[model samples]
Target: MEKRDSMDAFGAVSLIGFAALIAFNQVVIAVVNEGLQPVFFAGLRSAGAILLIWLWMRFRRIPVMITRETIMPGLAIGAVFALEFVFLFMALDLTTVSRTSVIFYTMPVWLAIAAHFFVPGDRITPVKALGLALALAGTAWAILQRPDSGEVSLAGDLFALGGAICWAAIAFIAKATTLRNVTPHTQLLWQVGVSAPILLLAAPLFGDLVRDLQPIHLWGLAFQIVVVVSAGFLFWLWLLSIYPASGVASFSFLSPVFGVLFGWALLGEEVGPVIFGALALVALGLVLINRPARAQVPQKVA
Candidate 1:
């Protein structure tokens, strides 16, 4: 659980960097989907991230020691991490990046709702409530505006929702379990290390592992493992350990905004007027939800 630490400038920068990284990730996932099956690609990245993280730690002389106290929680988070990506990758394959991002980035709403009951100091204030309404409305708008000419899928939307919930589950578990006390790398180790084998095993179940295999796909997988899975997640965990999670989480709204624009510019995906309007609402809500208050935002501790 986080303490009542509010967001500072450095925290804001970190959130922005993370948001951009993940926003770009949507484009990468879409590109990679051409050569690798969604689930299979996810599984490969999970496993590859394990090696990358280990190599990184080794180079940094950071010892990754797992004590008995951490095993169970680590394993639990690992499983959740695996499931989260499975749904996410599948959703990306089944739908456009704009649509998938619109739905998937609703994570803050779900997290706030769970925090209201499970986390102390997380009660939604009037402003926050309004923010939630706006954000949720934006998500609903995105789901509804399946542009007849654009690619959209119900199954994909559901899977994206599932992925968002699982994302919240990871946050909740981190707050509630011993993970809160561990180092960021240790926490990430639990996720990628545990998730690797499980995902690799499940890959075959999703059918053929390879598509029109290409060098670019391999490079994309490397980016997912080294940049996103290893470095990005570790940084997020560290942020969670130091800053108020609510503030950190509020930044997630930027991902969809960035994702949609990137999708259009990079992938040539259509962005309808409805999506632009939805982005406005979601952005407004995030600004309010993350607005600095008089008191430090109390992060929930299990």
Candidate 2:
């Protein structure tokens, strides 16, 4: 199929659904953490995703070969991927879904900053600078707002921030390295394939592999393996293939909002003005950052 120049109705609806699915996934993680250790749960998700992704690749006839040049980056990205989910799961275990989502979804802000120094043809402009400032401030604001509730944890907030950084690094590697030569499916294969063993091996260092352990938790893990980790990611990559990347990315701001709502609605988590303010700033900042640069007007010749 040919790529569309802009998002249409189908794209808009699909993107919204995807955002909501991702936001709800945070709630699932929090629930699942009750029965399984955070790091162990993350490892299991990666381990399970490996088989699903491999099967999909085989079905689609997409080659999973990694060239010699991409091997270093493949390992690098996989290691970073492991670190990302470790922090994310740990954060969710220690903090409220609202707080984690608000901070974790700031991946684009960090990615833009990293790209400024690392990726060619990706220099930061004045508008992007403003966006960066706002997003960074929003992140700080989210981290600093502490209520009397026992649900909030400073360490958890920082872990969420770390997860966002690792997520940005993964995107940076995809953009700036030879890994870009491969299909998105192949790159995703690298992430899950390499991270599974590393995460599982490191899981014991975090804590025991299981908590009280329940069927709901087992179901949660299966949902993550099949829905969020495999199908959800593949759907996102499919969207990128069909729409302008920026246009597709513009909808990301919605995920945090949906996350906050889901946290409040599903888990009975509190949502306050401070978090709302942070969400507004972050969302606006993302909009600005992803906004296409204005076309330059030609000067009249003498």
Candidate 3:
């Protein structure tokens, strides 16, 4: 395979891995959420991820360097990371995984818009505009499909949307600021370390205190720590370091696709034609928005 194709393949696999991890985590969380508090669950997962990654880094003899400049950006990113998961876990509690994933994967749309304003070379092209419109339309459609049982939580959907916006903001900040200079492992470490304590403190306010934990809760925590946070994020960061950012980003749409499939398979959630159709639009939009533009050639004089 060509280099780009190989990179694309890696990106695809990384995305699939992320999708699988998320689907599995959702199921585990759904079970564990019944026993433990969401914030506590999030904190424990972060703690586990931190421990695992720290061990791996120690085994590999990787240095943990913290500079004054890196500290602020790392903390900033960590704060956002904490908020993102808090909102996400709350969303999962309030809404279905399928709905939450569809709304959350709208990160690319927000990223494109944020890039248009922030990044130097990224402008709002017509194709990107179209992509954003399609994504927005799909999100609206999903929201409208909520049942009339008066239990549908707009707050949860908005929280998911906020999480997506924060995700885009973090990506832009990482790109524009000096934060990118820090190693991905260090960045991740700072995020989890700083966020874990904060989540622990906020657990009570969010009604996420671990009053009664069970064996399955421990199993769920293990999966979140080992698979979802540690391995999945490590692979993601590795891909970002090696592959084109746009190429890697293009695969995120697959998360929702897999979310729906796994939600159906595991949670017995219903998947209608509208969900599939919305997923198609989201996938197409991601492709259009992230695909590289054709290079212009100079005309040759005979």
Candidate 4:
């Protein structure tokens, strides 16, 4: 089977898998929040992911050439990573999964929009434009639906939006800066390694670090470190390295769809007609965006 530069079968499958893992992650965070304050948990997760990735890198003998050139931009990316999770974890704590997911997963659209201006080959195509439009519509529709129980937090919604922007900013940095040449492992290290300390220092300001800390919570943190951060984020950046930014960005639209389903199944949250319809739009958009266009060949006149 041939692998194309846009989105190949493996790329599509990998992206969908990543989206599902991230969707399921929201539920895990909600559960873990029972034992840990959001910021502290996020900080600890980053710390854990750093250690995990470092071990993997060491075992594999992956040389992360951290020269003077990569240091400043690397720290900047890590700072962006810190801000992204700070807002995201807080959003998860303050809002329902459905609401936060709908709001937060808009990062792809934010990223595509920025990449259009900054990235050379990542300019929005007609299909991607359509996808972005539908994505925004679906996300907005999902956000508008009132939850059955817990009152929605405006602050949480805003935090989610901020997190989306921060997420976009990271993609922009990767595409538009020298960091593009850096290995995905090193890029991820910049994020988790730098974020660990920044987040840890800020964690205490948010209040108590631990709630009713339990064994399952420890397990949850471990899952986040191993699967979501270490494995999932690394996979995402790797996808970006091999595929077009717009195509990869478009696939992330599935996350909120999975998020809503998980929220319904795991948290017993309501999934109504509006959400179902929105999920369809998002899924449809993903198909459209990922469908590779064929070359138009000119015919000679006889």
Candidate 5:
């Protein structure tokens, strides 16, 4: 297959994997909600992912070493990872999953802005500016449409947005730093391993971890570890290596679209008109953001 075709295939696979991830994640979060405190559940999930990835790397003979210079940066990235998920779970706890997912997936918008400053040759063009406008408008539309019955909290929405910002920052750092030299597996390993203990430390502030866990909770933890975090992320990182980063990142917009659909199907969550409108805007923004800039052609001599 041509490289373009191969990249297209990778992009499609990434979208499918991400859609499955969104659905599975929502189910697990719902299950966790039944008993486990979100933070404790998050901690367990991270630990499980760490162990699973460690075992997988060992089996595959993938080296997991880090240079001394990379160590502090790796730890910093892991700290951001921990905070990102902490705010995400808190958002999940405080708001509807669909709302949180939609708001959180706005990472691309933040990423575009951050890239203007950090990523060389990735400065925001006019098209990207338009895309950012549309995204912000859609986000405002979603917020304004929130029901007066108190189903959505502005604080929770802000926290979810904060998670997105953290994610964008982490992506920027990963791309800008020498950390890119590390393999994706090692990057993820550092993230989960370091974040696990940080989460455990915060777990106590939230609730009693042992008392909250149930059998279903354990099942949720297992799914998150085996499927979502371990296998799913590995596949995503591999896809990124094979495909154009912009193409792969563009597919991330599909997650919220799928999240809304799965939220309606499984959670019986209502899909209001406002959400549909927001979806349209997000779709348009994604197109604008991902559209390749037209190449300039020199005018033919008369």
Candidate 6:
């Protein structure tokens, strides 16, 4: 399919659905963390996802070969990817979904900052600067404010922040290194393939692999392997390939909103006024950051 310059109705609907899926995923992770140790669960997810990804590629006839140029960067991104999930999974385990979601979804803010330094032509415009300020403030606020009714932890918040940084670093590696030359499938394969063993080996140090093992947790792990890791991420990459990146990214703020809502509605996590205010600020900042610059009209000779 040809790339679109902007988001059409189909793209808009798809993005909304994707955002909701991701929001609900946070709740799923939190629940699944009950039966499995967080790091171990993440490792298992990565390990399972590798086989699924490989099968998908085989079915789609997408080559799985890694170029020599991309090998080092691929390994680097995979390591970073493992670290990202380790922090994120642990964050959800240690804190409320609402808090973790609000903080973890701050990935774009960190990505923007890194892009300014490393990604050529991706500078900090005035609008983006304002967006950064708002997002940073909101993130900080979300971290500092503790809810009266639900679980909150400084360690968990910091873990989420660290996850956000790792997420940004993965994006940076993709943008700044030879990894960008590879297919999305190959990039994903690298992440899961390399991270699986790293996560599994490291999982032992964190704790026993299993906790109060349950059927639902197994089901959740399957869901993560199939829906979230393989299909969900691929769907997102498909959208990015087709639609304008800025337009696609503009829908991201909805993830945290839906996340907070799902946490409140599903997990019965608290959503106080402070959290809502932080959400508002971050959402507004995301809008500003992703808002496209107006086109310049060429003037005729006067």
Q: What is the C-alpha lDDT of each candidate?
A: 0.84, 0.92, 0.78, 0.82, 0.80, 0.90
Tens digits of per-residue lDDT for model 1 on 1-302? 44545788888998899998999998899889889998889888988888888888899988886888778888999899999999999988888888888788877778778988989977878888998899889878877767665357877888888999999888888787778777778778888888888888889998888999899998998899888988898878778778875688678778988999899999999888888888788778777776655667899999
Candidate 6 residue spans exceeding 4 A from truth: 148-150
TM-score of 1: 0.89
Query: For candidate 1, what is the lDDT?
Result: 0.84
Please rank every candidate by lDDT, starting with the best. 2, 6, 1, 4, 5, 3
lDDT of 5 by residue, 1-302 (tens): 22352356557876777766865596568658668777887888899898899999999999997999789889988999999988888787777777776788888888889888878888888998898889878877876678664656887788788888999888877887778899999989988988999998899998776656678777777888898899988988887777767677767777788777877788777778888888778767876777667668999999
Tell me the tens digit of each residue's lDDT in model 6 across 1-302: 78998789999999999999999999999999999999899989999999999999999999977888999999999999999999999999888888887888888988989888878888888998999899889999998887654468888989999998999899889879998887888899999998999999999998888999899999999999999999999999989989988999999999999999999999988788888988888888888888877778999998
Put down candidate 3 lDDT per residue, 23-139, tens digits, no spaces. 666667767776788878888888778888899889988877688888888888888888888887877777777777788888889888988988888997898888888888888
What's the CA RMSD for each of the models? 4.7, 1.0, 2.4, 2.9, 2.2, 1.2
lDDT of 2 by residue, 1-302 (tens): 68999899999999999999999999999999999998889889999999999999999998987899999999999999999999999999888999898899999999999988888878889998898888888889999987877778999999999999999999999889999888999889899988989989998898789899999999999999999989999999989989998899899899999999999999999999989989888888888888877779999999
Per-residue accuracy of model 4 over 1-302 as CA lDDT, tens digit each: 33356677788898889889999999999889889998899999999998889898899899886988888889999999999999988888877777777778777678778878877866788987997788778766766654555646677778888998998899778767888788889989999999999989998999999999999999999999999999888778777768876588667668888898899889887766876776777666655555556568999999
Weakest lDDT window of 10 consecutive positions for candidate 1 = 1-10
The residue ranges of model 4 lying beyond 4 angstroms of the native Cα positions read 1-13, 238-250, 282-302
Q: Per model, state how many residue pairs clash.
A: 0, 0, 0, 0, 0, 0
Instruction: List the lowest-lDDT window of 10 residues for candidate 2.
Output: 286-295
User: Model 3 segments beyond 4 Å from truth?
Assistant: 1-11, 149-151
Candidate 3, residue 300: CA error in Å? 2.7
